[model samples]
Structure formats: structure tokens, C-alpha cells
Target: MALLDLDPRAVATARRLAERAAAPVIDLARRHTTVSLERATLRLAGITGADHTHRAGDVPWVNRVVDTVRAHCGLDHGAALPVFHALAEHGLGTLTDLAEATAAGQVQYRVPTGADAARAEGSARAAIARGLRAVDRNRADRDRLVADLGDPPRRPWLYLIVATGDIDEDVVQAANAARAGADVIAVIRSTGQSLLDYVPEGATHHGFAGTYATEENFRIMRAAMDEVSREVGRYIRVTNYASGLCMSEIAVLAGLRRLDMMLNDSMYGILFRDINPVRTFVDQRFSRQIHARAGIIINTGEDNYLTTDDAVDAAHTVTVSQLLNERFAHEAGLGDHLLGLGHAFEIDPALPDSFRLELAHALLARELFPDAPLKWMPPTKHMTGDVFNGYLLNGFFNLAGALTGQSILLVGMMTEAVATPFLSDRDLALRNVRHVLDAAGGLAEDFRPAPGGLIVKRAHQVLGEAVDLLARIADDGLLNAIAEGTFGLMKRPADQGRGADGVIAKAEGYRNPATDLLDTGGDQ
Candidate 1:
């Protein structure tokens, strides 16, 4: 029973336009490869750790291997073959030994021909199979744990963030959050860690604003969440960013560590972090493939758009981006069940009918991707350090989530603009959400709008505008529309952003066994 009476033909048109808009970008992603994608392949091929002896920070083994292979024969033919060739036939003792030898200029990497190429491909496939098995084990562990424990109490699960700039502190905070009614805990990555090309190694405690999203950090938090899950008698989900320059690499690590959800948007790196469009598209496809195979739900970053652009004015852009994201995710084998498409309750509270408008937009998204576990975000851009009013605003946000049947509610804190939330702040936020949701648990069942009322009209208008925007984007191409500031009021050219240098056109016989295995749902 949808609250708004949306037109079915209009919805079909919007989806068709969205698919058309994403086709060119998806084609481009298919024909290109980025260094992060190669690094992800190496990571999936059982490569791990870093060689910090060569530099100040961790130079990951994947980087060392990919860089050596790229320097020797370029990655157009893929790094797996040459890398495996060195290890399999050359008798390189281990990946570490190969990394050391390559870094010391003692090894020459080349694409083998004939039987050697076959052997290298076979070995690469085998190594990647081992990595996939690890991912599979983690996925199975999550299922078994959830079956042994229990699921969340409601549809809109409470989501929280823990970012103390220390992995140990984050673990404590995450445990406390889960105990205090948070169903999903996202460990926010350190500020600016996204711009780095290499994934950090080991556990890190000294990040500027958040914890480093290292593999060790992921493992540590997973352990904590598991403990908290047992205590709460419900499975606790852990989330982290699989965005940035090393998007696919982080996705591999997240899968390896059994993360339940990841912040993975196709255009977030391009629009927000200034990563190259080609690089982001190439990397995101591979990352989403891994997420699909690992059974990790992906939460897109459409909510961040409203932070920079007016929520009401840019509401249709949110719809357009969601449609585009859905298409891209589907192309990578992600089902609607795994698409946690994001939107927010960020309307300015000063407007005469702001709450009504927010309802329209939220319900529009709910109706558009009904099967998706929509990640409804709370207000951040409009928080003016008014704790009292902020708390009220969050209540309204929670009400919207309940009324619209949002799947995941990122609980809003009152002291958002004041500082990092204290434990009390988080507790209060949880209380606010629990109250609204409890009081209005079945609100959506009875919440019906008039056939031509304000809410219904507004939703239709937004959908019409979204279809128009998608048609324009389809005509101009998604990249050019992005360059023309069609989203978030930011312009990122195709050839200009960070990581532009890492994008490469695929050559003949390019082979990535990880993609092959993931495409088959890791059965190989």
C-alpha cells in the first residue's frame, strides 16, 4: 500500500531514461581499468601487508606487485598473469619475497607466452580462488551467527557511526553503540584517507579525525561487533567506506573481514573527492562486483548531495542519481536486496511546508526502489548548534523514516554541529528514534495521501523532473552532465581529477580472474 499514488508509466519512463543515462558510463567502465582495480585483483589473489622499509608509510604488497608489473609490461593485459608468472614458474618463494625482489630491482616481470601464460593464468585463478574461499567463509560465518542469534527488531534498523581516531577506542564506542540500540555500526574512516592511493597496513591508532580503515582495524571491529551481537541477542552489522582511490582494495578487505555494509557510490569519489571520472567508474564496478559476491549491501552516498545543494531544489537529482546507481549496481550483479540506495531528511526547517516536502521526497524514494534497503540519512547541513531544536528536528526525521518505511535509519544527534557526539548524545539519539518508531510503527500502513494532494503532487513533480533530468543526462552522456554540474553543484571533468593517471585502456587478452570468479558468484 503506497502512500502516494504514483503513475506506473512515469516510473517506467524514469527507469528507462536512467538506464540510457548510465549505459555510456557503464560501457566506459567495462573497457577501462584503474590501478585500484588491479590492486584489488592482487589483494583477491592473496596479496597482503606493506613494505614500509622503502618509505615512511605502508607501501602495500599489491602496490609493489602492480607497480612492478606496470613498469615492466603495463597493466593493460592485467597484473595477475605477470605477477603469478614470477611466483609460479620463477620459484619466487612468496608474495613478500616477490615484492622485495621487485622493490630491490632484482626481478623482471613480463607477460609469458604459450604454455607459460596458461600456467600463470591457472596459478592466478587458484590464488584468487583461495581469497574467494576466505570471503566465502566469512559470509557463511555471518549467516550462521545471525541464525544462531537473531535479526533486528524492526524494518528501519538503527545505524550509528563511531569515529574516535583510534581503533581500540572505536571498538569500545562501537560496542557501546550496539548495546545502546544501534543495529549497524559504521567506523568512519580517517579524514583524507580516501585521497591516498594505497590501503594502510595493520592497525592504526593515530588518525586525525577518525580511525584508519586498515584491514586490521576491520578485523578488530568485527570481533567487537560479534561480541556485542551475542550480548544483545541480535546480529550487529559493521560498515566502512569502500570509496576513494582504493575503493576496490577496501572492498576486498571488507569482504575478507566480513563487513555487512559498505559506503560505495559510483560517482562519490568523482564528485566529492575529485577522483578521476574514469578511475572512479572503473574502480567502482570492480568494487561492486566484489560486494555482490561477498553478499555485502552497498549504501550509496546520495545523501551527501543535499549537504551542498538545497535538498528541495536538488531532490530530483537525488532521484536521478539513485536510478543511475541502481543501474550500475545491477550491471555488477548486485540484486535489489543488496542496493541500500541513500537519500536524506535534509529539507530546511524554515520553509512553510518543509516537513510535507521531505515526506514527498522520502516517500518518492521508497516507492521508486521499494525492494532496496534504502539508507535514510538524517540532517547534518542544517544543524545550527541548537541542540534543543536539533533534537526536535531529529524526531521529525525519525518520524519520516517510520512513515515511509525506511530500511536503515542513520540516527541523528542533537550536538552534531557542536562537536563529536558524547556517549550521552548517542544514547539520547537512540531514545528519540526508539520513541518515534515505537509510537508510529504502523504509521505507513494507515498513512494515505489524497489522490491529488500536496504530498502526491510534490512526489509526482519530483518524479517528472527526475525523468527530465535523466533524459538530458542520457543525451549529454553522464560524464558531460557531471562536468556541467548536474549533481552536488560540483564540476569534475573526465580527464582532470586525482587518480587520472591510473586509468588505463584494456589491451588485447586482458585477463582478471577475480572478475571471472566473482561473475560466477565465486563458484570457481
Candidate 2:
């Protein structure tokens, strides 16, 4: 299925280097925990609702429980060990009860004895197992729906974005897009939501540019998608961003609500959002474990690199990131099929032979990760106010996507830079993608670059550069490379960034049963 003749040795070398670069980071992730991660563990223990009576604000019960544990006993032994101990020793019935009593100043945490520790650990494992069973039920429901209703019968499933700053409004728009031939509907998160340290509660109506990614909103939108799926005869998949400070929290929520995909990448958070590398690494491992158990695909953010750096000049960086993403995701138990590795068509249109260069890059990614469901993004950095030119650029993008056999194609709106896309703009963009895909869908079957042709040569050159870059990164260490402004032109030190204070080193006797359960897809 490959178009270009690539060197297997070089590809192996790149993979080896990527794994070498990721080994140290993976070790760090294994030996550390985060506040959000512990909070997510509490959430999996069946804690819900918020403490509106608190003087500070409407704090989630998970937050209150974790905060109490952190302030009182510290988080070295993991939040679950102490919180569950408090419950068992005090004869509390549920984590919710413990959280309530903690908020009311009724529960006092303490280290437990032999019998008390055994009882607490056993009860905590049972509760976490129950929560994981809920996720198992959700996954079963999704599988049943897809089996009975079926999914889109095409490559490059049309992906559309809906961001109305309101959950109800987003539901209506998402259903309409489904009816209009969108295979996947991604509800864009509200602006700046990623930077918030905690996940919000309930369905929000007032956001700046996009809807909040709360569990309530996820439930509401997924319900609507199911209804529309029955009407359209194709199962509609829902997506949301699972990056930033509350990455693990959102991943757990997505599992409970049965989201189909999540925008998740630790490097994306560290480089673009200024999140601490250590914190991002720890959170992403726990988040991806949740995703792996929930049967959700993860879309990395390598495409965003092109938005900040020149696509032509930084092409090799995209490849290097993809390799590293593959290694990190694999280390976290994500198979190739679950990795929606990202790339984009953002080269300036005025550049000579830009379209050919775009094809070369796209083909290279497709060949590199053949089993991955590549999420091919369209041009945004080069989009101007000229709608016609933008539409034409999208046409070429669609053609490239179809030619390269992209698995998920995010539809590009012609009015991208001019304004937020109206429904009419989405319809027009869908029409453009449909025309190209229908007309030239099988072009790749007959498309063959000449021996040593420009396209083939460019691909080889980029692959060589990527291998070289991966070697340097492996030698320098991924964290040090990031601090040196290696990816996306951002310099984020491992020790200094947002949420660095949230990272906590694990105690010598630290243990988390959730990870043990999820390590084998929750069979335990």
C-alpha cells in the first residue's frame, strides 16, 4: 500500500531513537503523580457533586476530598490510599459520604493498622472496579450501536467542528452537521478552558468562543448524536479536547460519557500551553490509560506546529513529533489504531510547487504510520479573508487527503479567517470535499511517482532529516530538547511552567490500583 520506496533501516533507526528519547520521560511518569491524577482517582471511586456551601467557591467533591488529603496527610502515598482509609476507619459508606463529612469537618484522616489498611485497600479496589465497570458498560453500548447502526463507509471520514459557546446550541449544530454528512462531530472546548486547573461542573451556557467540556455537556451532546445516528443510519462519534491542566479529569469524564475521540498530547500542552513537562507527562499517562480502557481514539496536536512554524521549513519536525508521539502513546498502552496522529496542509499557497510538497509530506506520514488513523488537517495559517481563494485551497487539501488515504479529514471552512463558520459555510465545505473525494477517490491506486522524481526525493530527504533530528533529540533528552526550543519554537523547561507545583513525587510505598486494573484493560 506504499507509494514511495522508503528505506526500512532508516525507519527502524527513527523508531529506535524515538523510543530512546521517550524512555526517561516514561520512567518519570511511572515514578510521579499529579493533583489532577489523584482527583481523577477520587472521581473513579464514585465521588460526585460539588460543595456549594464552601466559602471559597462551588468546589467539586473530588477536589475537596483530594485537597483535604493533600493538606492533611500529604499525597506521597497516593490520594486513594488515604481517602479510602479514612472511609474504612470511620465506617463511611461511600466516597461521596467521606467527601461530604470532610467538607462538614467531620472526618479526620489517619494512618491505618494491619486490618484497617487491608479493609481500606480492598474496599477502594472494589469501588474503583465498579467505576471501571461503568466505563465497560459505556464501551459495550458504543460497540452495540456501531454494530447495529454501522459507521461511515468511507476513508477520510469528514470531521466538522461545532463551537457555539453553549451546550444546547452545540447539540443542535452537531445534529445538523451529522444530517449534512459529517462522520465525526467535535465540540470545540471554550477558549482558555485548558489553562483552568479544575474541570467545571454541569452544562454551561455562557462561554467565550466554544462550549465547556463538562460531563453534563458530554452526556447531552452524545444523547443527541445517538438520536441523529438512528435517523442518519450511521453512528456519529463525539470528540473533545483532553489536554491542559485537567487532562486526566476530562479523560475520566469522557470515558463515563462514552466520547469517541480526544485531542490529547503531552508535548502539545508543554510547548504550546506552557504546562510543566513533568506534570503533563504524568497526567497524559493516566489519561491515555483511561482512553485505552474506554475504547477511545487519541488525536495528537502535531498539526498545530505548522500553524506556528512554516510548514515547508518545519516538515521534519512534524515527522519527529509523530514518531515521539507514537512511542509515548505506545508506552501508555495505546495501539496504533487508537493514535490519530496529526499533520496539516498549511504551506503558503504562493510558494512554487507547494501542492507537490504537501503531497510529499502527507504521503510520508501515511507510509510511516500505516496502521494509524491519521487526522489530516486543512490549511488555516495561510487562509486570508478571500473566501474564494480559501475555498480553492481547501479543494486542493481535500484532493491531497483523498489521494493519500487520510483516515480523518477535518473539513476546512472557506470563511476561516473572516469569521466563525456559519452553517452555510459548513455545507459549502462539505460539498467541496465530497466532489473531490468522489471524483478522484481511487487516484492513489494508479498514482505512482517516477523513480527519483521530485516528490519521491522530497519524501526521502524529509525522512533523512527526521532521523537526524530524532538522533539529536535522543542524545539531548526530550526534556532538554524542549527546553532548547526544539518543537514549535517553544522553550519550556521541565522544572518551570504552569502547574509545576501540582507534580508530586511518589512515596516509596506508593500504589494506585486503578493503573494496575487498567494496565490490562481492566481485567482485574
- Local accuracy by lDDT, each model: 0.91, 0.90
- Which runs in model 2 stand beyond 4 Å of their true positions? none
The residue pairs in collision within model 1 are none
Q: Which residue window of length 10 is worst by lDDT in model 2?
A: 515-524
C-alpha lDDT (0 to 100) for residue 233 of candidate 2: 99
**Candidate 2 lDDT, 399-427, residue by residue in tens:** 99988889999999999898765689999
lDDT of 1 at 290: 88
What are the models' TM-scores?
A: 0.98, 0.98
Residue 143's C-alpha lDDT in candidate 2? 97
Superpose all Cα atoms of candidate 1 onto the true structure and report the RMSD in Å to 1 decimal.
1.1
**Model 1 per-residue lDDT at 314:** 93
